[model samples]
Target: MFWVLLLLLAWAVAGAACTRLCLAAARAAAVGDTGAGIGSGRDLTLYEAAFLSGGPRRVADVTLVAMARQRRLLLAHTGWATVVDPRGRDEMERSVIGAIGPEGQSPIAPVRAAAATADAVRGIADRLVRAGLAVPDGAGTTIADAVRQVRLAVPVVAGLGAVALLMPAPAEMPRHLIAMWFALPLTLTLSCLAMARFEVHPYSRWASPAGQRLLGALPRHTDGAADDRTYLTCVAVRGIRAVGEPDLRAAFAHRERYLGQDDGR
Candidate 1:
Protein backbone atom coordinates (compact mmCIF):
# COMPACT_ATOMS: atom_id res chain seq x y z
CA MET A 1 0.00 0.00 0.00
CA PHE A 2 2.84 2.39 0.87
CA TRP A 3 4.51 1.67 -2.43
CA VAL A 4 1.19 2.09 -4.18
CA LEU A 5 0.74 5.46 -2.54
CA LEU A 6 4.20 6.45 -3.65
CA LEU A 7 3.41 5.21 -7.10
CA LEU A 8 0.20 7.18 -7.15
CA LEU A 9 2.00 10.37 -6.22
CA ALA A 10 4.65 9.68 -8.77
CA TRP A 11 2.01 8.98 -11.37
CA ALA A 12 0.14 12.15 -10.55
CA VAL A 13 3.19 14.37 -10.90
CA ALA A 14 4.54 12.59 -13.94
CA GLY A 15 1.13 12.45 -15.57
CA ALA A 16 0.53 16.14 -15.00
CA ALA A 17 3.93 17.06 -16.43
CA CYS A 18 3.45 14.75 -19.39
CA THR A 19 0.00 16.14 -19.95
CA ARG A 20 1.33 19.68 -20.01
CA LEU A 21 4.06 18.62 -22.39
CA CYS A 22 1.52 16.85 -24.59
CA LEU A 23 -0.77 19.85 -24.64
CA ALA A 24 2.14 22.07 -25.55
CA ALA A 25 3.11 19.62 -28.26
CA ALA A 26 -0.34 19.67 -29.75
CA ARG A 27 -0.21 23.44 -29.78
CA ALA A 28 3.22 23.52 -31.41
CA ALA A 29 2.20 20.99 -34.05
CA ALA A 30 -0.84 23.04 -34.95
CA VAL A 31 1.23 26.25 -35.00
CA GLY A 32 3.32 25.41 -38.10
CA ASP A 33 6.39 23.89 -39.66
CA THR A 34 9.51 25.98 -40.03
CA GLY A 35 10.87 23.86 -42.90
CA ALA A 36 7.49 23.97 -44.67
CA GLY A 37 7.85 27.56 -45.92
CA ILE A 38 4.81 28.59 -43.91
CA GLY A 39 4.42 32.33 -43.43
CA SER A 40 5.20 33.80 -40.01
CA GLY A 41 1.54 34.59 -39.47
CA ARG A 42 0.32 31.05 -40.21
CA ASP A 43 2.93 29.75 -37.85
CA LEU A 44 1.75 32.08 -35.12
CA THR A 45 -1.90 31.11 -35.52
CA LEU A 46 -0.94 27.57 -34.70
CA TYR A 47 0.68 28.86 -31.51
CA GLU A 48 -2.30 30.96 -30.44
CA ALA A 49 -4.58 27.93 -30.50
CA ALA A 50 -2.12 25.92 -28.43
CA PHE A 51 -2.34 28.51 -25.63
CA LEU A 52 -6.14 28.70 -25.25
CA SER A 53 -6.30 25.29 -23.62
CA GLY A 54 -7.14 25.00 -19.83
CA GLY A 55 -9.52 23.70 -17.08
CA PRO A 56 -13.27 23.31 -16.19
CA ARG A 57 -15.47 25.21 -18.65
CA ARG A 58 -15.83 28.21 -16.38
CA VAL A 59 -12.12 28.26 -15.67
CA ALA A 60 -11.41 28.21 -19.37
CA ASP A 61 -13.75 31.14 -19.93
CA VAL A 62 -12.17 33.10 -17.14
CA THR A 63 -8.77 32.43 -18.61
CA LEU A 64 -9.96 33.62 -22.04
CA VAL A 65 -11.60 36.66 -20.51
CA ALA A 66 -8.28 37.45 -18.90
CA MET A 67 -6.54 37.05 -22.25
CA ALA A 68 -9.09 39.23 -24.04
CA ARG A 69 -8.86 41.77 -21.27
CA GLN A 70 -5.08 41.86 -21.50
CA ARG A 71 -5.22 42.37 -25.25
CA ARG A 72 -7.74 45.14 -24.64
CA LEU A 73 -5.56 46.66 -21.97
CA LEU A 74 -2.87 47.15 -24.56
CA LEU A 75 -5.44 49.34 -26.28
CA ALA A 76 -6.01 51.61 -23.25
CA HIS A 77 -5.06 52.02 -19.66
CA THR A 78 -7.79 52.52 -17.02
CA GLY A 79 -5.21 52.54 -14.21
CA TRP A 80 -5.79 49.99 -11.45
CA ALA A 81 -5.95 46.22 -11.93
CA THR A 82 -8.48 44.00 -10.12
CA VAL A 83 -8.45 40.27 -9.43
CA VAL A 84 -10.66 37.66 -7.67
CA ASP A 85 -8.36 35.77 -5.34
CA PRO A 86 -9.02 32.65 -3.26
CA ARG A 87 -10.04 34.96 -0.45
CA GLY A 88 -13.07 37.22 -1.08
CA ARG A 89 -13.78 40.48 -2.89
CA ASP A 90 -12.46 42.39 0.09
CA GLU A 91 -9.16 40.83 -0.65
CA MET A 92 -9.32 42.43 -4.09
CA GLU A 93 -9.49 46.25 -3.85
CA ARG A 94 -6.16 47.76 -2.88
CA SER A 95 -4.14 48.35 -6.06
CA VAL A 96 -0.74 48.07 -4.45
CA ILE A 97 -0.51 44.50 -5.71
CA GLY A 98 -0.87 43.59 -2.04
CA ALA A 99 -3.34 46.04 -0.59
CA ILE A 100 -6.68 44.94 0.96
CA GLY A 101 -10.08 44.67 -0.69
CA PRO A 102 -13.69 43.41 -0.34
CA GLU A 103 -13.82 40.15 1.61
CA GLY A 104 -16.16 37.22 2.34
CA GLN A 105 -17.29 36.37 -1.19
CA SER A 106 -18.30 33.03 -2.65
CA PRO A 107 -16.04 30.92 -4.80
CA ILE A 108 -15.47 32.15 -8.37
CA ALA A 109 -16.93 35.57 -7.80
CA PRO A 110 -17.66 37.35 -11.05
CA VAL A 111 -16.08 40.76 -11.38
CA ARG A 112 -14.85 43.13 -14.04
CA ALA A 113 -11.13 43.21 -14.69
CA ALA A 114 -9.39 45.46 -17.19
CA ALA A 115 -7.23 44.02 -19.96
CA ALA A 116 -3.73 45.38 -20.65
CA THR A 117 -2.85 42.95 -23.40
CA ALA A 118 -5.34 43.82 -26.16
CA ASP A 119 -4.07 47.34 -26.24
CA ALA A 120 -0.56 45.95 -26.40
CA VAL A 121 -1.36 43.94 -29.54
CA ARG A 122 -3.03 46.89 -31.19
CA GLY A 123 -0.27 49.22 -30.14
CA ILE A 124 2.58 47.03 -31.33
CA ALA A 125 0.94 46.22 -34.64
CA ASP A 126 0.30 49.87 -35.36
CA ARG A 127 3.80 50.96 -34.44
CA LEU A 128 5.72 48.12 -36.07
CA VAL A 129 3.94 48.83 -39.34
CA ARG A 130 4.96 52.47 -39.14
CA ALA A 131 8.58 51.55 -38.38
CA GLY A 132 8.97 49.30 -41.43
CA LEU A 133 10.13 46.41 -39.24
CA ALA A 134 7.30 44.28 -40.61
CA VAL A 135 5.89 43.55 -44.09
CA PRO A 136 1.86 44.01 -44.13
CA ASP A 137 -1.01 41.57 -44.30
CA GLY A 138 1.82 39.41 -43.02
CA ALA A 139 -0.50 36.91 -41.42
CA GLY A 140 -2.48 39.31 -39.23
CA THR A 141 -5.78 37.71 -40.19
CA THR A 142 -4.26 34.27 -39.88
CA ILE A 143 -3.14 35.10 -36.34
CA ALA A 144 -6.63 36.25 -35.39
CA ASP A 145 -8.07 33.01 -36.72
CA ALA A 146 -5.51 31.09 -34.69
CA VAL A 147 -6.50 33.00 -31.54
CA ARG A 148 -10.11 31.99 -32.09
CA GLN A 149 -9.19 28.34 -32.49
CA VAL A 150 -6.99 28.45 -29.40
CA ARG A 151 -9.87 29.86 -27.38
CA LEU A 152 -12.09 27.06 -28.63
CA ALA A 153 -9.47 24.44 -27.81
CA VAL A 154 -9.25 25.55 -24.17
CA PRO A 155 -12.18 23.55 -22.87
CA VAL A 156 -11.03 20.44 -24.64
CA VAL A 157 -7.69 20.75 -22.87
CA ALA A 158 -9.31 21.19 -19.48
CA GLY A 159 -11.39 18.07 -20.03
CA LEU A 160 -8.31 16.18 -21.09
CA GLY A 161 -6.47 17.23 -17.94
CA ALA A 162 -9.21 15.89 -15.69
CA VAL A 163 -9.28 12.64 -17.58
CA ALA A 164 -5.52 12.27 -17.48
CA LEU A 165 -5.61 12.68 -13.73
CA LEU A 166 -8.00 9.74 -13.42
CA MET A 167 -6.28 7.54 -15.95
CA PRO A 168 -4.89 4.35 -14.46
CA ALA A 169 -1.14 4.05 -14.25
CA PRO A 170 0.49 1.62 -16.66
CA ALA A 171 0.93 -1.84 -15.10
CA GLU A 172 4.28 -2.84 -16.55
CA MET A 173 7.53 -1.63 -18.10
CA PRO A 174 6.37 -3.14 -21.37
CA ARG A 175 3.32 -0.89 -21.35
CA HIS A 176 5.55 2.09 -20.90
CA LEU A 177 8.08 0.93 -23.50
CA ILE A 178 5.51 -0.08 -26.12
CA ALA A 179 3.70 3.15 -25.41
CA MET A 180 5.25 4.88 -28.38
CA TRP A 181 1.63 5.15 -29.45
CA PHE A 182 0.87 8.73 -28.37
CA ALA A 183 4.48 9.93 -28.08
CA LEU A 184 5.47 10.45 -31.70
CA PRO A 185 2.55 12.66 -32.52
CA LEU A 186 2.96 14.44 -29.21
CA THR A 187 6.66 15.07 -29.83
CA LEU A 188 5.98 16.34 -33.29
CA THR A 189 3.30 18.62 -31.93
CA LEU A 190 5.66 20.05 -29.32
CA SER A 191 8.35 20.69 -31.91
CA CYS A 192 5.83 22.57 -34.01
CA LEU A 193 4.65 24.60 -31.04
CA ALA A 194 8.25 25.57 -30.23
CA MET A 195 8.76 26.65 -33.81
CA ALA A 196 5.54 28.62 -33.79
CA ARG A 197 6.19 30.15 -30.41
CA PHE A 198 9.63 31.41 -31.37
CA GLU A 199 9.71 31.78 -35.15
CA VAL A 200 6.27 33.40 -35.50
CA HIS A 201 5.19 36.72 -34.04
CA PRO A 202 1.73 37.92 -32.89
CA TYR A 203 0.62 34.28 -32.53
CA SER A 204 2.43 33.71 -29.24
CA ARG A 205 -0.21 33.60 -26.50
CA TRP A 206 2.63 33.82 -23.99
CA ALA A 207 2.68 37.48 -25.00
CA SER A 208 -0.85 37.89 -23.62
CA PRO A 209 -2.01 38.50 -20.05
CA ALA A 210 -3.94 35.25 -19.99
CA GLY A 211 -0.82 33.34 -20.94
CA GLN A 212 1.57 35.37 -18.83
CA ARG A 213 -0.23 36.58 -15.71
CA LEU A 214 -2.43 33.52 -15.26
CA LEU A 215 -0.56 30.67 -16.88
CA GLY A 216 2.86 31.82 -15.60
CA ALA A 217 4.44 31.42 -19.00
CA LEU A 218 7.05 33.94 -20.09
CA PRO A 219 7.37 35.66 -23.47
CA ARG A 220 10.58 35.22 -25.44
CA HIS A 221 10.88 38.79 -26.69
CA THR A 222 13.83 37.55 -28.66
CA ASP A 223 12.46 36.49 -32.02
CA GLY A 224 11.63 37.96 -35.44
CA ALA A 225 9.50 40.86 -34.23
CA ALA A 226 11.72 41.74 -31.26
CA ASP A 227 12.07 45.46 -31.83
CA ASP A 228 12.24 47.07 -28.38
CA ARG A 229 11.24 50.59 -29.32
CA THR A 230 7.96 51.68 -30.96
CA TYR A 231 6.35 48.80 -29.08
CA LEU A 232 6.19 47.28 -32.55
CA THR A 233 7.84 44.06 -31.51
CA CYS A 234 6.09 41.90 -28.92
CA VAL A 235 7.95 39.49 -26.65
CA ALA A 236 5.89 36.87 -28.47
CA VAL A 237 5.41 35.10 -31.80
CA ARG A 238 2.18 36.25 -33.45
CA GLY A 239 2.01 38.70 -36.39
CA ILE A 240 3.73 41.31 -38.46
CA ARG A 241 1.96 44.48 -39.41
CA ALA A 242 3.22 46.33 -42.45
CA VAL A 243 6.24 48.55 -41.83
CA GLY A 244 7.60 51.72 -43.56
CA GLU A 245 10.70 52.70 -41.56
CA PRO A 246 10.67 55.53 -38.98
CA ASP A 247 14.25 55.17 -37.70
CA LEU A 248 13.69 53.97 -34.13
CA ARG A 249 17.19 52.87 -33.15
CA ALA A 250 17.41 55.20 -30.14
CA ALA A 251 13.88 54.37 -29.05
CA PHE A 252 14.57 50.64 -29.30
CA ALA A 253 17.68 51.12 -27.22
CA HIS A 254 15.71 52.90 -24.46
CA ARG A 255 12.99 50.24 -24.49
CA GLU A 256 15.62 47.60 -24.02
CA ARG A 257 16.92 49.53 -21.03
CA TYR A 258 13.47 49.66 -19.45
CA LEU A 259 12.93 45.94 -19.91
CA GLY A 260 16.21 45.26 -18.24
CA GLN A 261 15.33 47.57 -15.35
CA ASP A 262 11.84 46.16 -14.89
CA ASP A 263 11.35 44.78 -11.34
CA GLY A 264 15.02 45.55 -10.91
CA ARG A 265 15.79 42.38 -12.77
Candidate 2:
Protein backbone atom coordinates (compact mmCIF):
# COMPACT_ATOMS: atom_id res chain seq x y z
CA MET A 1 0.00 0.00 0.00
CA PHE A 2 0.97 3.72 -0.15
CA TRP A 3 1.46 3.63 3.61
CA VAL A 4 3.92 0.79 3.24
CA LEU A 5 5.89 2.99 0.82
CA LEU A 6 5.98 5.76 3.44
CA LEU A 7 7.17 3.29 6.05
CA LEU A 8 9.99 2.21 3.77
CA LEU A 9 10.99 5.86 3.25
CA ALA A 10 11.07 6.35 6.97
CA TRP A 11 13.34 3.39 7.45
CA ALA A 12 15.64 4.58 4.69
CA VAL A 13 15.92 8.05 6.18
CA ALA A 14 16.58 6.88 9.71
CA GLY A 15 18.95 4.11 8.73
CA ALA A 16 21.04 6.34 6.46
CA ALA A 17 21.35 9.10 9.06
CA CYS A 18 22.22 6.81 11.94
CA THR A 19 24.68 4.83 9.86
CA ARG A 20 26.42 8.01 8.72
CA LEU A 21 26.69 9.32 12.25
CA CYS A 22 27.97 6.06 13.65
CA LEU A 23 30.51 5.73 10.85
CA ALA A 24 31.73 9.27 11.31
CA ALA A 25 32.10 8.71 15.04
CA ALA A 26 33.88 5.46 14.43
CA ARG A 27 36.26 7.08 11.94
CA ALA A 28 37.06 9.89 14.34
CA ALA A 29 37.67 7.46 17.15
CA ALA A 30 39.94 5.35 14.95
CA VAL A 31 42.41 8.06 14.02
CA GLY A 32 44.41 8.09 17.21
CA ASP A 33 46.87 10.78 18.28
CA THR A 34 50.17 9.69 19.73
CA GLY A 35 52.92 11.73 21.38
CA ALA A 36 55.44 11.18 18.59
CA GLY A 37 55.54 14.54 16.87
CA ILE A 38 57.39 17.83 17.30
CA GLY A 39 55.71 18.57 20.61
CA SER A 40 56.47 15.26 22.24
CA GLY A 41 59.08 16.25 24.81
CA ARG A 42 58.77 20.04 25.04
CA ASP A 43 56.35 21.96 27.17
CA LEU A 44 53.60 23.70 25.21
CA THR A 45 54.31 27.30 24.32
CA LEU A 46 51.73 29.93 25.17
CA TYR A 47 50.50 29.93 21.59
CA GLU A 48 50.29 26.13 21.48
CA ALA A 49 48.48 26.07 24.78
CA ALA A 50 46.10 28.73 23.51
CA PHE A 51 45.34 26.81 20.34
CA LEU A 52 44.85 23.53 22.14
CA SER A 53 42.58 25.04 24.78
CA GLY A 54 40.48 27.43 22.68
CA GLY A 55 41.70 27.34 19.06
CA PRO A 56 42.86 30.26 16.87
CA ARG A 57 40.68 32.88 18.57
CA ARG A 58 42.27 32.16 21.90
CA VAL A 59 45.71 32.65 20.37
CA ALA A 60 44.67 36.10 19.19
CA ASP A 61 43.19 36.91 22.59
CA VAL A 62 46.34 35.93 24.45
CA THR A 63 48.53 37.88 22.04
CA LEU A 64 46.43 41.00 22.44
CA VAL A 65 46.43 40.70 26.22
CA ALA A 66 50.20 40.13 26.33
CA MET A 67 50.99 43.14 24.13
CA ALA A 68 48.58 45.32 26.05
CA ARG A 69 50.21 44.30 29.32
CA GLN A 70 53.71 45.08 27.96
CA ARG A 71 52.61 48.56 26.84
CA ARG A 72 53.20 47.59 23.21
CA LEU A 73 49.50 48.05 22.52
CA LEU A 74 46.73 50.03 24.14
CA LEU A 75 43.43 48.24 24.80
CA ALA A 76 41.03 50.85 26.06
CA HIS A 77 38.00 50.07 28.18
CA THR A 78 35.86 51.49 25.36
CA GLY A 79 36.84 48.73 22.85
CA TRP A 80 39.49 50.60 20.83
CA ALA A 81 42.96 49.15 20.33
CA THR A 82 45.86 51.57 19.76
CA VAL A 83 49.26 50.36 18.76
CA VAL A 84 51.92 51.90 20.92
CA ASP A 85 54.72 50.10 19.08
CA PRO A 86 54.73 49.78 15.32
CA ARG A 87 57.28 46.98 15.44
CA GLY A 88 55.91 43.61 16.54
CA ARG A 89 57.89 41.21 18.69
CA ASP A 90 56.70 38.17 16.69
CA GLU A 91 54.49 37.08 13.83
CA MET A 92 51.40 36.90 16.02
CA GLU A 93 51.94 40.44 17.27
CA ARG A 94 52.61 41.57 13.73
CA SER A 95 49.34 39.98 12.57
CA VAL A 96 47.42 41.94 15.22
CA ILE A 97 49.17 45.16 14.26
CA GLY A 98 48.50 44.60 10.57
CA ALA A 99 44.86 43.88 11.31
CA ILE A 100 44.60 47.31 12.98
CA GLY A 101 45.69 48.89 9.62
CA PRO A 102 47.88 51.93 8.80
CA GLU A 103 45.82 54.37 10.82
CA GLY A 104 47.21 52.44 13.84
CA GLN A 105 43.85 52.26 15.56
CA SER A 106 40.78 50.07 15.23
CA PRO A 107 38.04 48.40 17.23
CA ILE A 108 39.30 45.49 19.32
CA ALA A 109 36.54 43.27 18.00
CA PRO A 110 37.61 43.44 14.34
CA VAL A 111 41.25 43.29 15.27
CA ARG A 112 40.66 40.06 17.18
CA ALA A 113 38.65 38.62 14.30
CA ALA A 114 41.24 39.43 11.65
CA ALA A 115 44.10 38.29 13.81
CA ALA A 116 42.41 34.98 14.46
CA THR A 117 42.25 34.27 10.74
CA ALA A 118 45.67 35.66 9.87
CA ASP A 119 48.46 33.54 8.46
CA ALA A 120 50.17 33.45 11.84
CA VAL A 121 47.14 31.79 13.39
CA ARG A 122 46.80 29.39 10.48
CA GLY A 123 50.43 28.46 10.87
CA ILE A 124 49.86 27.72 14.55
CA ALA A 125 46.90 25.49 13.69
CA ASP A 126 48.90 23.70 11.03
CA ARG A 127 51.72 23.03 13.46
CA LEU A 128 49.36 21.72 16.08
CA VAL A 129 47.70 19.42 13.55
CA ARG A 130 51.07 18.14 12.41
CA ALA A 131 52.15 17.63 15.97
CA GLY A 132 49.14 15.40 16.58
CA LEU A 133 47.73 17.71 19.21
CA ALA A 134 44.88 19.33 17.27
CA VAL A 135 41.98 18.02 15.21
CA PRO A 136 42.42 18.33 11.46
CA ASP A 137 40.47 21.22 9.96
CA GLY A 138 37.32 19.47 8.67
CA ALA A 139 37.83 16.22 10.52
CA GLY A 140 35.87 17.30 13.55
CA THR A 141 33.14 18.84 11.40
CA THR A 142 32.31 15.46 9.86
CA ILE A 143 31.09 14.09 13.17
CA ALA A 144 29.19 17.26 13.96
CA ASP A 145 27.47 17.28 10.59
CA ALA A 146 26.53 13.64 10.87
CA VAL A 147 25.06 14.26 14.30
CA ARG A 148 23.00 17.14 12.93
CA GLN A 149 21.77 14.99 10.06
CA VAL A 150 20.65 12.27 12.44
CA ARG A 151 18.87 14.81 14.63
CA LEU A 152 17.06 16.18 11.60
CA ALA A 153 16.08 12.71 10.49
CA VAL A 154 14.25 12.03 13.75
CA PRO A 155 11.46 14.52 13.05
CA VAL A 156 11.35 13.58 9.38
CA VAL A 157 10.80 9.96 10.30
CA ALA A 158 8.07 10.87 12.76
CA GLY A 159 6.30 13.03 10.20
CA LEU A 160 6.41 10.26 7.63
CA GLY A 161 4.97 7.79 10.14
CA ALA A 162 2.17 10.23 11.05
CA VAL A 163 1.29 10.66 7.39
CA ALA A 164 1.26 6.89 6.86
CA LEU A 165 -1.06 6.37 9.81
CA LEU A 166 -3.50 8.91 8.37
CA MET A 167 -3.65 7.01 5.05
CA PRO A 168 -5.77 3.85 4.39
CA ALA A 169 -4.57 0.64 6.03
CA PRO A 170 -5.03 -2.98 4.85
CA ALA A 171 -8.02 -4.92 6.18
CA GLU A 172 -5.91 -7.10 8.51
CA MET A 173 -2.89 -4.84 9.25
CA PRO A 174 -3.77 -2.67 12.25
CA ARG A 175 -2.99 1.06 12.66
CA HIS A 176 -0.96 0.28 15.75
CA LEU A 177 1.19 -2.14 13.73
CA ILE A 178 2.19 0.68 11.39
CA ALA A 179 2.96 2.81 14.43
CA MET A 180 5.20 0.11 15.87
CA TRP A 181 7.09 -0.02 12.57
CA PHE A 182 7.64 3.73 12.73
CA ALA A 183 8.67 3.41 16.37
CA LEU A 184 11.58 1.17 15.34
CA PRO A 185 13.25 3.97 13.38
CA LEU A 186 12.48 6.46 16.16
CA THR A 187 14.11 4.18 18.70
CA LEU A 188 17.12 3.76 16.45
CA THR A 189 17.66 7.51 16.15
CA LEU A 190 17.12 8.16 19.84
CA SER A 191 19.39 5.36 21.00
CA CYS A 192 22.13 6.50 18.64
CA LEU A 193 21.90 10.05 20.00
CA ALA A 194 22.17 8.83 23.55
CA MET A 195 25.18 6.67 22.74
CA ALA A 196 26.81 9.54 20.93
CA ARG A 197 26.40 11.72 24.00
CA PHE A 198 28.58 9.34 25.99
CA GLU A 199 30.97 7.91 23.39
CA VAL A 200 31.53 10.57 20.73
CA HIS A 201 30.39 13.83 22.28
CA PRO A 202 33.62 14.41 24.18
CA TYR A 203 35.27 14.81 20.80
CA SER A 204 36.72 18.30 20.83
CA ARG A 205 36.72 20.40 17.69
CA TRP A 206 40.19 21.74 18.49
CA ALA A 207 42.13 19.47 20.78
CA SER A 208 42.59 15.72 20.37
CA PRO A 209 42.81 13.33 23.30
CA ALA A 210 46.58 13.67 23.37
CA GLY A 211 46.29 17.44 23.38
CA GLN A 212 43.70 17.25 26.14
CA ARG A 213 46.09 15.21 28.24
CA LEU A 214 48.82 17.79 27.78
CA LEU A 215 46.47 20.61 28.70
CA GLY A 216 45.46 18.81 31.84
CA ALA A 217 49.10 18.36 32.86
CA LEU A 218 49.86 22.06 32.81
CA PRO A 219 49.97 23.74 36.20
CA ARG A 220 46.79 25.61 37.06
CA HIS A 221 47.15 29.37 37.44
CA THR A 222 44.46 30.94 39.61
CA ASP A 223 46.21 33.51 41.80
CA GLY A 224 46.41 37.24 41.05
CA ALA A 225 50.06 37.45 42.05
CA ALA A 226 51.27 35.05 39.36
CA ASP A 227 54.21 35.93 37.16
CA ASP A 228 53.78 37.01 33.55
CA ARG A 229 54.25 33.44 32.31
CA THR A 230 51.70 32.03 34.71
CA TYR A 231 49.24 34.82 34.11
CA LEU A 232 49.48 34.69 30.35
CA THR A 233 49.28 30.91 30.46
CA CYS A 234 46.03 31.23 32.34
CA VAL A 235 44.71 33.71 29.81
CA ALA A 236 45.76 31.46 26.96
CA VAL A 237 44.10 28.42 28.46
CA ARG A 238 40.94 29.96 29.89
CA GLY A 239 40.53 32.95 27.53
CA ILE A 240 40.22 36.70 28.27
CA ARG A 241 37.85 36.04 31.18
CA ALA A 242 40.81 34.74 33.15
CA VAL A 243 42.54 38.14 33.04
CA GLY A 244 43.02 39.34 36.58
CA GLU A 245 43.28 43.05 35.72
CA PRO A 246 39.96 44.84 35.98
CA ASP A 247 40.82 47.17 33.10
CA LEU A 248 41.73 44.31 30.77
CA ARG A 249 38.52 42.50 31.59
CA ALA A 250 36.54 45.70 31.01
CA ALA A 251 38.26 46.25 27.68
CA PHE A 252 37.24 42.79 26.45
CA ALA A 253 33.70 43.29 27.68
CA HIS A 254 33.54 46.52 25.71
CA ARG A 255 34.81 44.62 22.71
CA GLU A 256 32.03 42.05 23.11
CA ARG A 257 29.36 44.74 23.34
CA TYR A 258 30.80 46.48 20.27
CA LEU A 259 30.68 43.18 18.37
CA GLY A 260 27.03 42.70 19.25
CA GLN A 261 26.19 46.21 18.00
CA ASP A 262 28.21 45.73 14.82
CA ASP A 263 26.52 42.40 14.10
CA GLY A 264 23.08 43.99 14.41
CA ARG A 265 24.01 46.35 11.60
Worst 10 residues of 2 by lDDT: 256-265
Candidates in order, TM-scores: namely 0.24, 0.78
lDDT of 2 by residue, 1-265 (tens): 8888898899899999999987776655544334345556668889989888877878889999999999999999888899999999899999999999999999898898899899998998888777777777877455667888889999999999999999889988999998998999999998988888887665455776567667877755678667899888888877777888888877887666545632210
So what's the TM-score on candidate 1? 0.24
**CA lDDT of each candidate?**
0.30, 0.82
Sequence-dependent TM-score of model 2: 0.78
lDDT of 2 at 215: 81
Error of 1 at 111 (Å): 19
To one decimal, what is the Cα RMSD in angstroms of model 2 from the true structure?
4.0
Could you give candidate 1's per-residue lDDT for residues 1-265 as a string of tens digits?
2323434443444344444544544444343332123332222221132222211121212232333233321111221224334322221111211221354221111221121123323343343323322222243233334534444344334433344435664565333432343343334434444554564433432223122222223232344454432122221221121122222112122322323432100
